[model samples]
Target: MEISVRTPAVEPRAMWSHSCTLDDLVTPYAVDPTVVARLEAGPGWARRWTAVWRASRARVVCPVPDLADFPTLASAPVRSFTWQARQRHRPGLQFVLATSRMHGFESLEERRLLLALDFTGGIEEVLSQPFKLRFTAIGGGEDHTPDFLVLLNGTAVLIDVRPGHRVKDKDLVKFAAAERAAASAGWRYLVVTGWRRHVAAGLDALSARRRPMADRLGLHDELLEMVAERPRRFGDLVEATSLPAVARAHAVHLL
Candidate 1:
């Protein structure tokens, strides 16, 4: 007797955020027209951005005027990483299923943000340390690099990761500069303070089944058929399956 194996099913994107809590995690930054004009005239605005927008190995110099129409999804990180001894911050790489690439992160909070973005889905591309942003804020000349540049539904979103309490007065200045630049380029800006209650925990649990899984026993189809009628409690849904123990993992994948 011969047994045939089927290809594994792709893991569905996790929708861990609830409607009520989405606002708490994502905070948009807006500014008045005067500040926007000042930022555009500053050095950061006059200076070109260093990015790899065309080829993976080649870097492109982009002017601020061209940013609104730049194809960010095709871009690469502005700079690479080299770890040194006793670094105060934790630096690591995370493999994102969305882009099938290992993204670099300078800190643990960045790592979590990557996971959340990956699970959220609809992101075409994610580039770490995407560009070197130089802007003159109220204080004086300030040079900064944003954490990540993500393309969602063909729109560019510039993101910075900083805990609410950790954000100081100077940090706000840099953020404001970034926000203004991002706006000038027709891109959205967001400061992710932190996740809402239970969102992190839920993401952890769902990520366990984030990879492809083989339905050797045909339990995936059976599980779906069972839930076709109406929504069922997770515990009860798994318990009603043909093989409850194995179905638990499949059920989570189906979610």
Candidate 2:
């Protein structure tokens, strides 16, 4: 069965000529194959050589609650019209907008629809798609559904979302295995922990204090403080941190 899922739409307004530069237009998202396919399928579509200033812009139409509701935008205004006339009236073509003015995107395949959702709607579901890849530990195995897993810069990785926890060694092993697989597979992994400060203060007594620890770099003051006092348990982080939104990544490093 062929799946023709609508691609994530771009907010072209953020790419104004005077405001945007050559580099912004060259990134992976800007020239994504899936994105380009959708654009080329539009009327008057041209792959211009004049660069970004003259390249055709993608539509930025009225906002509805979701991609399924975007068709409601066609009846608005002509100036507001994106492919305003006929394409919107096509026999069978779907247009979806899963855009944000403040962030970047990292899709998995050249042409595909990925997991997307709004708050309170994201639930843990099995990898129903056969193409969805996951790592298996040498023997440890995966957990009560991972906290989160989705694509980024074309890689699939795990995310942690529990607010706080009394972590178990078994959970740690599963996470460690996931990390190792991600590295070998060239995917990114992340473990976002919260409440570092409180945990740190609590661990200070157990730590071998070095007057001023060098582990204070890059982390939030709270987390840095915790690490400064002593080593931390992975569970401490689970208790403190919240999982990142499906569309927004919390961590960037390889697992």
Candidate 3:
């Protein structure tokens, strides 16, 4: 009996963000905040954001522009940086703009870091490798749909293939719910964006099982325990990590 191989689903491309350090891109427009508010939900797989604009009246509002001001925005005001990070979070893209003024608030170096994320695409490759499980790549499914609900080792893993960037409340909620559910299910859950997107310069096949990720996530001992003890589902993992949402899901995947 031939076990016909199944294809992993193809994910859609929504409005992913683009990072920029340009100060001229900042513009405070006046519109009914409802639309902006709805858009401010940022990009993700959820469909409820439309309702937010339905009840909103045409009110004058200043929407913080996209990551156009990320470079200068950090230097301008922490509040501005935070706001941009929240508004410009595209579901598909990384929007990798750093608001940190670390290392004596250096400018050139920060830009370089941001540039590496934008051009080199390191985050997508690195992050994607750890989140995936071994499976035959029989390509099928919708091109415009969100990632398919994946089951690895009999555990559900919800993947959102966005790039590395600031975390938002909406995205946080989905990831959080997955984390909560995984803890309840004692399963593995992950949001694999960035790093993998760029293919880590196409080294995915070579370094798919790299070991450094365990150290980065700080999940060495916990992983050892879970595999040995065997979690039943999400709930078990949650209890094991005592972690909530994305962090919890992350811990489960680490194992």
lDDT of all the models against the reference?
0.71, 0.28, 0.30
**Backbone collision count in every prediction?**
1, 7, 25
- Give the range where candidate 2 is weakest over 10 consecutive residues by summed lDDT: 46-55
Comparing 1 and 2 on lDDT, the stronger one: 1
- Model 2, 1-255: lDDT tens digits are 222223234533443223432122221111123322222122321111010010123433221112122231132111221233445221221111232211111112101111221111222221111111222333422332233333333334444322223334444544453344344445444443222222234223322231233422333344445546875554564245333231011111100
Higher-ranked by lDDT: 2 or 3: 3
lDDT of 1 by residue, 1-255 (tens): 221212224333445333323234444333335544544353554454322243467766666556766666566677667689988888899988888999999888888888888666677888898877766655566677789988777577889887665766566666777786687678888877666556677777878888889999999998889879887889999999889999999989876
The 10-residue segment of model 3 with minimum total lDDT is: 47-56
Q: List the residue pairs that clash in candidate 2.
A: 106-153, 161-243, 163-239, 164-239, 165-239, 194-241, 200-226
Compute each candidate's TM-score over C-alphas.
0.78, 0.24, 0.23
Please report the TM-score between candidate 3 and the true structure: 0.23
Error of 1 at 84 (Å): 2.2
Instruction: Indicate the TM-score of model 2.
Output: 0.24
